[model samples]
Target: MVVVNVYAPNIYTNRRRLWDKFLSLCNSIEGIWLIIGDFNEVRVPEDRWNSVFDNNNALHFNNFIGAAGLLEYPMLGRKYTFLSGDGKKLSKIDRALVCSDFMTKWPNTSLRALERNISDHSPLILSSGASNYGPTPFRFFNSWIEIPGMVEAVNRGLNKQGNENFKDLLLG
Candidate 1:
């Protein structure tokens, strides 16, 4: 997994040169590749909010991803990964990108945005493992009792029999 934090310069010419070099380097590499971090640019207009969308920048960013054969991993738990100091402007400048080989190897891979506490960008957590640590904790919801068929559904789920042992259940 290759983690990159590209600092795209404000000047358009400089930005193109930097991205070109980066893409060339990535293209030369072999095997599964996963890139993640702040790109300083967005691939689409939807990626930004409360700000003027730059069509040219978006086009360039999308072109870079296509040239590198990298697929942006879908983010979970949030729409925007970045927050301005005033908590007004929002954008998804940080993301995870993986090549096709990497995706094939870890088909269940997922990226989640953790709470943004220290910085403007939210920290991302990526995991491929699907292991279950333990039995899911049961929570009693007072509203559930008022719902129709809730009792029957709960009883059915609780009484369901399975041949798997405790070890299998624990491991999921």
Candidate 2:
């Protein structure tokens, strides 16, 4: 089983480009796929927690998703995930979507809204494939180095260790 994540930027007003890229990506992938991120688009006026704003922009995005054959993952928390800084325009900007293939491959894919960490947009967690193992901490260390060399180092370490445990922890 393979997991693919797609994070598209907010296309609040550009539906053509968004739809075109979505179509190209859907046709290109072969296995189970999941597209999860802040689309900045809405499927319907009801999708927004507050419906008093200009929603012409959102309807266009909804059409794009429908035409692309992608289904929205019904939100579990408060419908609104993003709010304009001024506290006037509220919208469901962050969301996750999946194709039928993903359902067949990993039916348990669940997305939840995490606390907003870096950006105003909430973090979307898309757990596609099942894992008996639970959540693992993600580490980020900035080291100025060559990208290809990092790959080579990882490959060499894997080959030498052959799935041995604690190598990463020990090295760190």
Clash pairs of candidate 2? none
Clashing pairs in 1: none
Candidates' TM-scores?
Answer: 0.71, 0.60
Which candidate number has the best TM-score? 1
lDDT of each: 0.80, 0.63
| lDDT tens digits, residue span 58-93, model 2 | 666666667657776666655577777766666776
lDDT computed for candidate 2: 0.63
Which lDDT tens digits does candidate 1 get at residues 1-172?
5656554675767777777987897888666777777777888889999987989988887898899888977899888988988989999988888889888888898999988889888888889969887776546789988999878777666566776543324221
Q: Which stretches of candidate 1 lie over 4 Å from their true place?
A: 1-13, 132-172
Could you tell me the lDDT of residue 79 within candidate 2?
59
